[model samples]
Target: MNRNTPTSSKPVIAIREADYGRLTALAQVTIDKDLAVGDELMAELERATVIVGEVAACRTIQMGSTTTYKTGTSEPRTVTLVYPGEADIEANRISVLTPIGVALLGLSKGQSISWIARDGTTHTLKVVSVGK
Candidate 1:
């Protein structure tokens, strides 16, 4: 059963069942810590449309997806959404444990959303494209 839900009032987001396992572990560990965005990450996960990996469809922003997005009016930038251990700001790889990274997951091309930074600053990002 592909859990591709259309969150009509909110932007549509989807996730693969395989990644769900690890993401849940991360959330379970982080949510109990102070100053972690784990709660937010958990919320995003809860709303995701879960599907089997093989037939999860195309263009869904799962881990390892190289995505191009714009933050508010800033110039567009591209980054590969990765796990915390693989994140390197200079290399443009973002960790899914981060606020923005968590927000970007399960999103498709042309979707937009506002995410809160660790410092409490809010930023709006629009996904321009998704690439494998």
Candidate 2:
């Protein structure tokens, strides 16, 4: 996905059947209230171009030239998002299973969010752009 353009309009979120089921099960087990919002979120995830979660949460992510500027860092880094099986950090390409990968899922361009790193430090990032 291209991470240069702004995502102003809300696009559809997509999710795999298995992933949807897993999320639903998790919500059901944890929350007592009716998971209507969670259900709707899953439906929306089906059409999502971006997703947000931990590294282990994503099944796949689009690969392309995208730049990321860390929340408190000045230098912007470019990286490619590859499928889980093809991710290589040394090449500046990462799998969707990585920390930054999952946190970026389902997010639109211009949206800023935070996620905890493996070291327990909070990391914030912004969606600079997204493309399929």
Candidate 3:
């Protein structure tokens, strides 16, 4: 298969149309700072199905959405998704540029995503809930 193909192992994700442009710009700028994660984020965005004209009704994880997710058998953690400048671990705000944030983006409740950590270990995160 080609490089950009979405393999069956990767779940299809949905992104809001309004967020697409900004996200693309973010991903592009991130490449200079972190190649692996930046490329991965760009790929994810490229393959996502864009939701149009239904921003308020979307249940998928997006910027500013508070999400609860679990990894492995660990307890779920709740965090608010935010831009890089706004991230504060103490505040439970996660930056979309981070691996966990990228994995959680565009996912709805019960959706799971697999991502490679900066350490190169593979991990999976399952979305338990999403709240605005």
TM-score leaderboard ranking:
3, 1, 2
The C-alpha stretches of model 1 lying farther than 4 A from their native spots are 1-9, 54-57
How many residue pairs clash (N, CA or C atoms closer than 3 angstroms) in each of the candidate models, in the order given? 0, 21, 0
Per-residue lDDT of model 3, residues 1-132, tens digit only: 112224567787888888889999999998867566687778788778888866542688988889899999999999999989999999999999888888888889998878777786778888999898
Worst 10 residues of 2 by lDDT: 1-10
lDDT of 1 by residue, 1-132 (tens): 111223354587898888988998898788767436677677778888888855463587888889999997799999999999999999999999888888899988899887767777777888999888
Taken over the whole model, the C-alpha lDDT of each candidate is: 0.81, 0.48, 0.82
Candidate 3 positional error at 93, Å: 0.6
lDDT of 3 at 111: 83
For candidate 3, report its TM-score.
Answer: 0.88
Put down candidate 2 lDDT per residue, 27-57, tens digits, no spaces.
3442345423333333334445433453422
For every candidate in turn, the CA RMSD to the true structure comes to 5.0, 10.2, 2.8
Off by over 4 Å in 3: 1-6, 54-57
